[model samples]
Target: MESQPESHLLKLRKDTKENVRKIYNLDKPGRLEEAIKILQHWIQKQDHILKKDWNADYLDKTLIASKGSVEKAKKQIDRLCTMKTLIPKFFEVINVKKELPTILDLAMVMPLPTQTEEYYRVILVKIDTKEIKPEFFMMYFQYCLSVAEYIKTHDYANGFILVYDCRELNLAEVITKISTVELQQFITLLIEGYGARLKGIHIVSESKAIEMLINIVKQFLSEKVGNRIHVQRSIEDLPKVVPKGILPVEYGGNEKSIKELQEEWLEAITSEEHMEHLKVMYKACTDETRRNAGKFNEEYMGMPGSFRNLSVD
Candidate 1:
């Protein structure tokens, strides 16, 4: 297998790495190395895990998401593999070149090139059409996971800030198409499976349907995360919460236009090198037959399909 290539779409800021090291207490002599070693050993011992050769960079990001807790990181890794195994809909077909272009045509969900002053990466999700199909939601979820996977392997950041542009959205059309059960699973995969440390969720819209949309989405979020969501009356109001300078030119910022950013990301993610990387990552799922029955039941009792009553909180 070929080694994963470095990311050309996104680059860590000059001070970002140093800042993360200090904040995560990785600056101490051998601290980060020791943590990675311990996690590596645990992975080797887990018989159910099919892909145990996770690189140091991957382990380091897992630790950062766990906030330096080794125990939490272990559980996170377990849940990640388990979720991928159980949820084939999201992990089964990751052919970016073939599957992603259609979804991109419908809506744009791309991470901005600029990181915030605090080093949190920003993701821009722009939904322009109201003619959303029921099947497209799953494709959208898959696209998100693809982006998250790309970030996991390449980018380093304190957390993620999601900027959702709903100016042209028809909430009534969108809400009916979105299944609560699927929503739960997608959020679980994003936070637990991918270790996405979400910092904020900012919705940009002027539609009266904003309230209804927020109410529905809030059900899947914890109080802490729910509180982080803010609705902007207009794009002009966005800079109040998110920096204007880092935003796309369409959003009244200095950066590239949304179209340009999206095109660049599309090309980068669909490149032959990244496609190979995704092929390897798709095999990182666990073999449930090999997993201890008791441990499996204990850890994933509340997984989406296991029970009708699901709560991400």
Candidate 2:
């Protein structure tokens, strides 16, 4: 995969880089570079990985996401490639313009341009229409992953804060349409496959049924992650968790409106350069035949391939 040009990449604040390094215990001289080298060597040795030539920046992000553990980074990379190979439905047809318009019309999922004081990138999900469909669950996740792919290459951050604006959402209607199996798969892919370090998840809603939705979501998350979820009775309370300066104007902040940000992100993911990049990335899957039989069974035997008989521990 071609590396995004330096000029196009998001510029990280000098202090943000230093702070993240310190937090991840990668502040020591040559420590981060050494970890990247070790990860690169490990990838080259893995016969199952079809693409061993991963970019340095990609390796760095993987290492950071692993919390400075080279071993965990190794597992993370293997799981990601394995999922890409097994879950063809998610990886196939990544053309944003052709495949995502319907879902985009129902809701907006975009990473805000600014970072919080703690340096966590906030991703805003706004559901505007009451006409929710069952198929939208997958498409919504696919869109989020598309944006994540962009972040993997261009941005630097400590973790992510998800702001889910569901004020207009019909939770009772959505619950009936959702499949528990697919819900588990989406959570797994987000945390395990993509290595998303979720600092927090803020759900903005006034509906009493919001608790029902939260209960369903928590079943798929670890106790620690479940504890990170905060329910907001109003958008006015958002500033207490996510700072005002970074939030969009609609939420009583100084940044651009969510509509504007959504449009900009839509344009970006559908851009010719990014579309070609997604096609190349969708091909970075594992070759199971080349993998060690014992290791493959030990690692992935429990996983539900193609969403058949899915079970989450």
Model 1 lDDT at residue 182:
91
- Among all candidates shown, the one with the greatest TM-score: 1
Inter-residue clash pairs, candidate 1: none
Q: Residue 233's C-alpha lDDT in candidate 2?
A: 90
Name the weakest run of 10 consecutive residues (lDDT summed) in model 1.
304-313
- Give candidate 1's whole-model lDDT: 0.82
lDDT of 1 at 159: 92
Query: Compared with the true structure, what per-residue lDDT tens digits does model 2 show for residues 1-313?
Result: 1222442323355577778878999989999999999988988999889988898889888888888899999998998898887776777647665877898788898787777778788888999778778888888878878888888877778999999999888888888888887777778888888789999999998888889989999988989999999999999999999989878899999988888888788888888888888888778888887887777767887765443332322
lDDT of each: 0.82, 0.82
How do all models score by TM-score?
A: 0.93, 0.93
lDDT of 1 by residue, 88-191 (tens): 77876466657666777778978887788898888999988878888888988988887888898888889999999988888778877888889889988888
